[model samples]
Target chain A: MIWPFITRSLGIATILLLAAIGELLDERAGVLNVGIEGLMLFGGAAGFLAALKWGLLAGFIVGTIVGGAFGLLHAVLSITLKVNQVVSGMGIWLFAMGFVTYWADRYSGPLPMGMVSPSIHGLSPMFFIALAILFAIWFILSRTHLGLKIRSVGEDPSTAEVSGVNVVKIRYLCTTIGGLLGGLAGAFLTLTYLACWSHLPTMGLGWVALALVQFSIWRPPILLAGALLFGFIWQFAISPETIYAGIPAPLPVLRMLPFAVTIIFLTVISSERFRKKWALAKPAALGQPYIKE
Target chain B: MIGLRFPKLKCERIVILTGADAVKISALSVVISFMLFGAFVAFEGTDPLVAYEHIFSFAFDPKLGLPITLHRGFFLVFNTLAFIIPMAAGIWNIGMEGQFYLGTIGAFAVAYSFPDLNQAILIPLMLISGAIFGAAYGALAGFLKGKMNVNEVVVTIMLNNIAFWLVYLLTVGGPWAGIAESTSKPLPKNACAPMVWNTPFTSIFVIVVAILVYFFLKKTTIGYQIRTLGSNPIVAKHVGISAPKISVIVMAIGGAIAGLSGYHMWAGDPAFLMIPRPEAYKAIGDLTYWGIILGLICLLNPLTSVPASIFIGSIIVGTTVLVRRLRMPFGLDVLFLGIISLVFAAFQFFHQYRIRRVKVVIGK
Candidate 1:
């Protein structure tokens, strides 16, 4: 029971890790994207369809590419055109939710769960991919000169520009990479973890990832720690049938565990009093569209 | 290497829109959304123009769908205002979905308990209870946002899921089942919304509320304070305006209106007269999102929200007509909305900048 729980929880956490790291990169580069929710849906739908036509591997690549494409659209709107990031993200979400639902109904029937190989410790290679990506991101963000430039851009784009950093290109590059990872996460969600696609296969996990970015305070290693805890809680709450066998709690109520936890944890972590210390280092220019003069 | 000349695209932030230009931009947004949406429909192996014909026949004036569109508009207006009112204080009230649901439960509580109460008394009582429930929920989010600085977007979103689960618990054989397990017990038919002009009387009620909200933002002292707070918090702070208090008050007000819409949507309507099944949010349930979209579309103007609601309502009603006819693809409502929002955002760019064609020299 413990082993199975650990494996399942890690599997769930991987999804969060992928999406959150992508978002963290954007935030670190002084951009806020609230549309990761829709991006994930687009990735899931596209990945599932591609997998149906091609194979599992094609699904992953297509999903990532689709996500990157949407990310580019978002980048053009937010970074280039300087549209309101939140509204643009919300628009993307509404479109994705609608399009995915309609597409799923039109093109897909009940799908058989696809199988993946090379499961180490009962976790697929997706988990390793996530760990490796997480490690790489951690290294690039902390130890590299590019990391300093990104931080400088997030803190003060004008200053960074004066320092010779091309703020727009860096922001766009980060956003595209973020979208790529987000897409891969969605592909993994449909083609590997859940093994099938539905209307919203991620089920607001993208939002949970958004919350996780805040919870981790934008640090990569800390994010990993938080994802593990979140993963365990999510797994526990998602399986009320097993957990609440003796207590007889309502299933839907139990199903809301992860969301409820997200809200509770978010409030506690982000409350002004608690954040006075941690919010100090938060990206200063985050959510502000920089206009080149 | 030889140099070749080509054209490159550029934008200047100098071209500001005139009054007429604003209207043109707005029209451009609608046209682009329609074209993009139509392109999707055409790609789906159908005649997009023919599908639109069925929609217009159903959704426009002098048709059977006008009343339904207006009825839907009433709810969309309230939802829009729900966003607009709190917006005056710079608070984003995305919790209308949860607040609306709680209002239904609140309305259901009153109607179920006093089924034999007088029509006038019962309806008013239901409305009050609904408003109270909605306001309390909204205020909770507001309080967290104001005092605790919790992110309202995530909090409201989570609250929506919680509210829906609560609905599922109550209606699905959990002490509130009426004719079926998935519905609350019916309210007395006499408790229906007072109707006039072939639409819910709430149509008039919504207009009055919108006008009142417009005045509330423009004329009142608190409105001034709200405006100042929204425009600049540092000035508000110096003026001794309490940010948290205003946040809670505006959110509560917004929530109250959305909650009132809950009664109008189902409980107080002759068509429903009780909360019905969860059809992916239990009808008019997830429609709270339409308000969010409309709030953005109207640029958070309380008065503009009314006509905008009607426009959106017609589109939804029209698309719904096409969905029934099976001549058009489903999800057109959301597709249209997403396109509208995206186009509006894009146009916001155009509102400030004009495209400039620059000549570029290339090495070949």
Candidate 2:
């Protein structure tokens, strides 16, 4: 029984895990892409539309491309134009939300029959893909020179520039990759997990993924843990009886648990003592835009 | 081939814009954004001109339009202030939506608890309690950000979800469950804000608050300190300013303003409290989002936010007209707003740096 519960949690957590890993990479390059939520939404709509018209493979490809495009837009706005990252990110989110919503309303009608996924050895292929990506990201960040350059750019772009790294190009590349992962995560939601396109299907998972980045302190492995924890909390909220004999509180209150836990964890990690303790994990210049002056 | 020498071209010096040039560029950006939006509307099969006409006619119809527009604009004033005040201190209080709902809950708690109070007494009590509740909620996020160094954006977003659920638990199936599943009983008549000869409670209150905020920001010592802190925190610290305390104070004030908007939303218009429908939730979310955009457009100036609020309010009213009359899809206003703000953000870059073309002289 516990095994099934854990498996279910992992299945649900794939979306968060993938998006959080993407954000981890993005933040490691010192570009905090707050528009991940919007990018994911755009990907969901794009993937769903393409899946309806063509096939699931097309859905994934189109979703990723759309997400990458938005990521490029964010890069242009934040990196090239030097807009305030927060405003531009939020603007991207609004644009994605509005545009996707408008198009989805006109296009998406109902889920076609038999669109659900077939389980692979009692687990989802998407979950395995997420795990593979997580391992790949961890390996890249920990073992590669390119990863070192990305980290250097995040930590101190001036030093990196003096060291002859192209800070702008690295940032753009990382942001686009982050967006691709975010798009893939959204595709997973539509093509595998929910198996149907719904308005804002990613919901606030993109945000939860963002918080998980902070919780993980930019480490990919720790992000996997944070995503699973949030996922289990959500599952527990929705299906409390599966674990316990009776319900604890009202469903609404139960649903608040995941968000409340995120706050508590964020507060704990944000403390000066903890930050000092984990100094290496925290990116020194996470959200600041790098201008070659 | 030997006679193919090119004429010498003079290069224009690329100088950063200042003062009037910056303003002109910003105005141009706004116009460009509108033109793009007009094109988008035209693509949707409605003549952009016709859409604009309907929007203006609906928003300016004296008998119906004037009151509704003012009513909507009044709430925006408070919401926009909720964003700009904290923003002036360089903090993003995106949790205004949560604070608004919490304020409604606070006002309703007071009004529901005291059923027979005098109108004069109950009104002030509700407003004060509402503001205090909102302040407390806002201060929670501020404290986390200031002391714990938490990312206020993430915290505020989480708090938004938490606040919605709390409201849902209270109004849906918990202690304050209404006659209907998602609504509470109407506030007592005495608790409702009294109207002045055809004007709303918010119209008067928003102006008063706007004036107070303007003076407080422009003429007060703390306000000056806040402005200094926002521009340069390192310098501010050298000058003995407490960043944490200021953050908490600014957020609290912002929360108070948003809380007042909640009170107005509840008692001023629909005159009852309900868990907003999903569509209404989208509208409220857009309201705060646009409030932030408007605040930025006004360069975080409170006095300017008043007119900005009215302009945004007119847009909101216009979108509603578009939906009702032209059968356009929902959330077009937010899409337009998103594009406009993006254009302006790009323009901010141009305002700072100019691009110039230089001719290369051969054999120099």
Full-model lDDT for every candidate: 0.82, 0.80
In the range B1-364, model 2's lDDT, one tens digit per residue, is 2343455544233364456665677668778987887887888888998998888788867765655666677788888888888888888888888888788778888888997999888888889988998899999998988778788988888887788777777776577766764565656767666677455576788888888988888899999988888888999999999889988999899989888887787677653444454446435655666667777777776777787677767777787777888988776776677777777767666655666555544554
Q: What are the RMSDs of all candidates, in order?
A: 3.5, 2.9
Model 1 lDDT per residue over B63-157, tens place = 57888888888889988999888877887777888999988888878887888898889888988998999999899888988888887787888
| Model 2 stretches astray by more than 4 angstroms | A1-7, A106-110, B1-22, B271-282, B356-364
The model with the greatest lDDT is 1
Among all windows of ten consecutive residues in candidate 2 chain A, which has the lowest summed lDDT?
A108-117
True contacts kept of 2: 0.64
Predict model 2's lDDT versus the native.
Answer: 0.80
**Which regions of candidate 1 are displaced past 4 Å?**
A113-122, B1-10, B14-23, B61-63, B179-181, B268-271, B280-283, B355-364
lDDT at position A222, candidate 2: 82
- Report DockQ per prediction, comma-separated: 0.60, 0.67
Once model 2 is optimally superposed onto the true structure by TM-score, how far is the C-alpha of residue B328 displaced, in angstroms?
Answer: 2.0
